[model samples]
Target: MNQNYSKKCAPRRLMTVTALAAFLFAPASASLFAQAGAAASANSPAADSARSAARAADPLRGTPSTITSAGNEARTQQDAFERSHRLGLRFYNGGADATCEVALGRICYWNNNGDVPPPAERADARLEREALLEVLAKAQRENPKDDWVNGMRVRYAIEGGQAEVGLEAARACGGTDWWCAALQGLALHNLNRHVDASAAFGRALAAMPEAQRCAWDDLTLWLDPAMHANYKALGCSGRGAENARVFRLGQPLWMLPGNDLQNEWYSRFTMSRVHSLGRLPYDMQWGDDLLESQLRYGWPTAWSVQNGGAADPRPPQVVGHEPTPSYDFMAVPSGIGSPTQATAKDWEPTRKKARMRYSTRYAAGYGALPHQFARFLRGGDTTILAGGYRLMRDLEMGRAPYTAALTLDGFDGRAPLQVVRDSAPANSALLVPFSSTMLASVEVLAPVGKRAARVRNTVSPLPRETRLSDYLLLQRGDPSPTPTLERNATQAYGSTEIEGGTTIGIYWEMYRQASPSAPLQVSLRATRLGASFFQRLGSSIGLSKALTPVSIKYNDNGRPDGGAGRSLTLNFPSVPSGDYQLTLMVSGAGVTDSTTQVVRVNSGNK
Candidate 1:
């Protein structure tokens, strides 16, 4: 239960970017969880003035807590609220004396009647929540400075899927302190304003004591023991950048939209505080099951009651607890491998599968976007990173051009080696000048829609001494009548997916070849890719030739000028349509190099 995360929330001061500050709202006075820094520490009158000024500058820093309700119902509700928490005190020992966290949501079902409600008999609980909110809204008007009144309104709004309402309530909370910052962060997160939400959450964490702050820093809550060990050994150090890299790698499907994992941290912060004193039948602490379940698999998207059909319905063993029931591909830490691994070359499909167990799964995830990338030698030292990223059809519902950013990141996923941004139609390309040969992750982000797609490919740059640059795949795209060696990274077909009747352009450089006219051996072979195990075995043993391989071999006479560029074409073969692999190899005096890639063919060939 005790963790080192119980240290300073973060070590650095927050710097709000100019552009981001432009969208922020005017600050108000702080209440329960407010602080006025050194300015408010001065003598009486000066301290009061400084506290007032500080509230105008930041939401989490200000005066002491004294939120009084005006008259009758307002005062009675306040008393009732504290009394309601009386029973909760028996379970949640966290304390109201210190800490900005308070569970504004109802966590217990006293009317369980010792049985889980059957699906047909279950009433819509949200309706009751809605009705109560109507009264709370009225009370909020009467007691504009009351923290409890406003905080409850914000909670109901967020859980009820009314993000804008939540934001309104959060902003209205009299105290511009922890309650304000945290409530606003959750609201902004639901609105997909991650930058702002992160800022707000940062402020809330700043208000917490070291112990509580550290508990919120733990990222291994969702990991199984083995994966948790592997993850913890990653040496994250709780730095902002390090945590970001970890979150990026943990995205279940990079292609899916929204920074779900990032939002999840703040989401857990709120949930932990609410369920801190959970009630339960488990032998261990109450709420431990819910905590363990959420930490490991993430919050479930939906819940359905399974009746005690065969057993006695008494004592209601069934609860409204259900993990994501959909078959999904959970995201594990990617891009950056272990502290020991580097370069994309060290990554393979097998290792990816092995690590997948640690990722938290989700339903209704985003679809994969097509992409293509190639590295070409640039000025001997620099490498030209050219890539094409496409927004899937469903996501490309508008004419507004999509922005694509291509970034070459280091082994630690730290400072990027190079980053290039460009905008185009649904299909976009980015060509960046890079100069790294170590392990790296080439990432592309198509940030659009409610949930979008992100792609990160880990790779080891080809040795600078290699005899060939990566073979670039191209196609005659829209508005381009003829395919040429010249390319528009943004317009290039990211992947070789063409009608079987069309031809795809192939480009590569024959490095260190003999003289320009010297004879060299060239071989281009097309084989079955994405075939079944038995089919692949047949090809391996010469057992089947249903789709004969496309083989081209020739001798080339060339005196190379650093073998910077060369061009060729490969047409889709006449075969049952699916996917195929094309490999090209060029051999000179004592040097040889080859590249292979899969091309999807859409036409059916008998």
Candidate 2:
């Protein structure tokens, strides 16, 4: 769970090749949330006098001698780059005769890339699926000189619905089968398919052979460690080992290793011990680096295609107040053609130049609040003020606090999902008014009674635009057979509603996708609002970041630049008097969004 994600509470780069320093750690079954480890050594006092003179010249006093001469010069340049790119072992040519016709195991290209026909409603009373469809119809009537088990019996006769009997059984079974023409172009893309699954994954990537086109994109990222060692060496325990650990946690070489760990060295020794192995058996499969570089750098995290416009849409309600409880998937609406009418003089300056181009991509992902504000709640307490929570747990155990977490589930009604605090006395939650910009205030809390709670706020985003994969997507994970491709900028919840005296407000316009590959989650919800003319426009303006609590009952005690002020009074008689709620949860490096509001105590009350 430590792939060093930065970009906000970010900065991690430790990779000492030789003298060994690959500690990593973060995949131990997703480390049960709440994390902020590995990051406390900022050369203080010259690194405590160089670790007290390398611990008095070492006797293994925590291994020293200038850190073992910089880990033997990084293990002699990682053994001269693995002895100049070694490359010896290479066999599995016919892929163990296509894993002895699947009854055995090994040749795994995303799971047997073939064989699956006997289903026309179990073709008349199945007796072991009609003797395994009479041994796959006598291996397609003996057309087998084994070109990878007759290219898995022509991809199980074009996925069974037989595209012209799998192109007449691959033209009466051909010889140089490149998986029988990628199973007759994937049995004509399983019937209702697209120009044949794109001409069968593009003629299986043009029958490879152009020096194996980067070995078939490194064998499509070794489709999860050779399909979890050929489904546990074919015993297939009814698809066991927890279904090969969900196809090796959805493969991609668990985010950037290579040659599928030297052609399977026990799946790179189980991805070097899956972050110190934990999590009872699964959950976390190697931690962050944009999900282990999308499984060993194969990249492309997810894609489903076929978007004939609108299907699973409704989701686009971002504007203010969100203390959790949101999921809007861009709120649908793309019906495509027919609906033109412009011409009110070219639609009023093209709707003001498309509202200044979506407000400059929403102010390039938002600003304000860059460190200096802490008071966490919802279980593990942490408090800091104007540099609070003990300087934010000394920047979460030294440099890096925005750890990350926010989950809200399905609601029941009166909306306004709760978790608000700072009942006045200065715990500000968005006030802004003073004019020419810059008077910001945002506070969302939960503490005092904590009703059926499930909120996790680990702030830190003002640190010069946040990155390093947004601090390795906030650590905690493990269990590995290599396969990683995560993208959840943080915002997970399911059941909702938990009110408190309410008051809400928000104004955001952020965006950043100039080729963003992942990282985005912005959720915000809020209700309870009587506005009170926004407290008479925060006393006719002087917006000193809000907090005026004590005791003023003012129809006129006068201060907020007095000029045109009346009825408002709050001056901190030690502040904390009643009803509350506030929410905001923005994310990047997995993109996320959120907003919510509420706050009370007004009849000139204190």
Candidate 3:
């Protein structure tokens, strides 16, 4: 029996020693078993049901489908509200006054998913208001002079559409602050106190930070009708008058290259009002002739409002009076209105009168027609007569491309009129006046080369042969000059590749009856690739003085027979290395033609 007892005690003692050794040497293994058991228990259905119930009580839980799910969601939200409310109370009891108020305020205005029913939204809103009021009451008791708290109160009042209350709260925070002043302005604006609101906005603007000034300006522009009216009343002289001036200049002038027209018009209009008419509201700065001239001409010169007065009270200063040579008689449509029923015969007398009138004005050193005389020229039936006289003069000069007669209905009778080009031999245009306040002369000229002589060239024979024929040479200076009428021709030459600053020789022949004494006007223009459309348009309008000018006199004095064949050479200016187009326009008595060739200026000689 003693041996048996000893054996059992030995086994028990040995087992206990083994367990202590395992705990000391293999502690991680023991921890793994415990974690595995806990994980198994956590994944059990009972544990899952408990977790679902907990999630159902959480207001922040994701929504689920079904009416029952929605009800559970509502209950969970209520539980969350209660929990926050209790937590806030505890914080308040613990003497964290500000923190407690903030917590309560957050709970009151808590934003829930918009899927909440209308009743729930209303209830939540009421709870929010109550909580905010509680926060305000506590804040007032704790820190009555705190601007942050007062600002919150003001924001809350404004959010609730209580403008008067918002104003009171803002005033309590000191009306000098930008935010406070802005709030006061909004409140006043809402209450129909526009003057007071404007003052408040002004104060706010004065105090606003530089970074936020633009936002303030935008707000003022949007909300203040009186500000807009005041700006408009000042015309071109007030603080914001630049915008009004731009609008009054109209669209035709804006389509030009730069802001020269706009600036000149504003200065002239302001000067006329202030200096000439003694208008009090005009800007005196615009009256200084030296400064005005510098601003307009970019140089110190005499101020002359009469410069562009021929077209309008303020015409584009860049518009030159140096008319195109008589041979280049293409007429541009002037933006003047005329009577719809007037005929060309009726305009003959007016044309004669205007010629005399313009000559007298020019001789007298009066730059442009006086305002009254210009108005007279643009008034009544004489307006149509003026336009008619222009048309007849163009017709008589053989400048009109189309043989169409002048009909009064085609002219849109508006400023910046559109002249439609038609293929008919009889080119006819109508002028229909919509307004009696017509602009000065609206000269309509046909495109150049419309009635001019035809210049032609052949490229297959090196040193291309250029000549005049019954038809215009549709392709002049072209690497491949193919006559419209197919005559035998060889291979077409490729574009000329020349080094920069080198002169290219152009060879062409003139086929027409010409008096030897008549000098031919030749214009050679080089257009670089990627040039602006406006630049190209200016070139077409005979305004491009950049072109190289050339003149060739046909010495027919020795030869009685009219000369038909002629050749000419032009030296172009040094051009940069790039792709370019060289256009040659040749004009002589009753003949005008143009040809273009592609030129590639290589960087270095190949």
Candidate 4:
């Protein structure tokens, strides 16, 4: 709930309280998908009218379905309509009329059906669903042009948490190809197949009318003001990262296969259009309140009566499928710098805090494994993204099937990035087309035991001519004196976190522009952060009381014409546990360059 949820809601009887909404799951339906299948034929007047309507003469489906089928088409439609009507009425258990009153942007005076009783538990819902689907399938075969029939078949399957069924229904649809594509997109989005879903949505948008496409393309419908404005100026038509960033990020908890947010957005669009034609529940205030309720927070997975007998918002709560961090939704992190740089603070916002709070963010259906990578200018204008990751979870004696994937979203248009997937290999190098300002999200996922970890961000391409590549940390125990991207992936730790008095390995490649074997002046230093006052004071002057900084300086020879670079196992057992900014600088042929990374050291006991 936002800051205005309590103040704006006037009537105590009807409150959009989280706990209340969480309890009541409203069960029933009141839409045309159940009854509005007009059973039209090619020459029928209804068919002609629907043909003229373009999108749909009337399109919708009622809640979860309790409609039945009869022997004849007309009788079946009538039976389904009557059954849904009864089911809708049963929402209040026995209400003759349910009243609606909108206030302060919420349902305020919902009191027509006096003393609203709790809705009865839904029973035989499966049987009712099968009957309704049978009728719709027959209707679909008979009148394939009716958009409602096609939409209901898919929507019902998706909402019921049956992804395969939803996909099949979407594919079997015959109305508008665009509509079918949109349906497929919805199903694919639910399954978290972002690339495929984006392709489907792209097809739908391509086939839609320009005006409709513009409406669908509007980011303002969901984004906060600041972000919306930012995206407005982005001119990013080729970026397909928006849906994954929004739907999954909006409710990342992978409890259900389908993304509730996507379906909710779809539902809102359908309701806005269909309700305008006047078939939905009347009570203008109720509609506004309900619409805003869904629009602002999210659509409810289910609704039910308040346990404490609250009268108003009557089925007094609307539970969201899952909550997104709305507090930060409206604006970017203030201290974060401009989005131009790959290393900007806003690039990977949740890293520091999340990694610190949780030992492993590999819970539920998602993960956050740590890894280090470096981009090298390979031949043929391709930048090779080389990295390795180590897993801390699912370390059983038996080797389980694992999939390590390097996914790069926003690759370009609807085409997916071509890369090989392996079963937890330590090190691999991928070649990608080079671009200076490419805002690509490169994710390295090597999940084990179904729960996996992934580290993703936009890495700026290496300069055309550079002195050295980024540091790749490795396990101090590894025997390989020279680090290669082809090492066993599970051997290196991505978390630069270490324990006090522990040694670790650092590896890097020297890109000597002059002679490959040129001798270079190399210096490595670890500066303690938040140093004690005495330590700072001691360092101000050259005195015996001053402590020697954790520093290592050496002269190193660069690699030969076709040689791999160099590495060192670093250990400072005397260095106290703290945060350190580890800097590596290399000077060769009078040109100097450097890179820095943060490494944390905890007490030995920890």
Indicate which candidate wins on lDDT.
1
Candidate 4 TM-score to native:
0.62
Question: Model 3 TM-score?
Answer: 0.20
My TM-score estimates for the predictions, one after another, are 0.62, 0.20, 0.20, 0.62
Counted clashes in each candidate structure:
30, 102, 25, 14
- Expressed as tens digits, the lDDT of each residue in 1-606 for candidate 3 is 000000000000011122221111101011111133554674579977986676455322223432233233333443444334322221001111111100110010011111111111134544764456446434533543433344445544544446676667556554236655655555554444445655665676678676555432221221123345544455332434333222222211111222322222222222222122111111111223222222222221111011212443322111001001111111111111122322222222112111101111001111111000101012223322111111222233243453211111222323432222233232112222223332222222233322211111111111122333111111122232322112211111112444565543443334444444665665556667765677567666888523222233333321244433222334444544566766656677666776665665665422
Residue 558 error, candidate 2, Å: 31
- The sequence of per-residue lDDT tens digits that candidate 2 reaches over residues 61-94 is 1233222333333324333322221111111111
> Could you tell me how far off, in angstroms, the CA of residue 415 lies in candidate 4 after the best superposition?
7.6
> What C-alpha lDDT, on a 0 to 100 scale, does residue 286 get in candidate 2?
25
lDDT of candidate 2 at residue 371, scale 0 to 100: 22
How many steric overlaps does candidate 4 have?
Answer: 14
RMSD of 2: 29.9
lDDT of each: 0.48, 0.25, 0.31, 0.47
Which residue runs does candidate 2 get wrong by more than 4 Å? Answer: 1-132, 135-137, 145-177, 180-203, 208-527, 530-606
lDDT of 4 at 376: 57
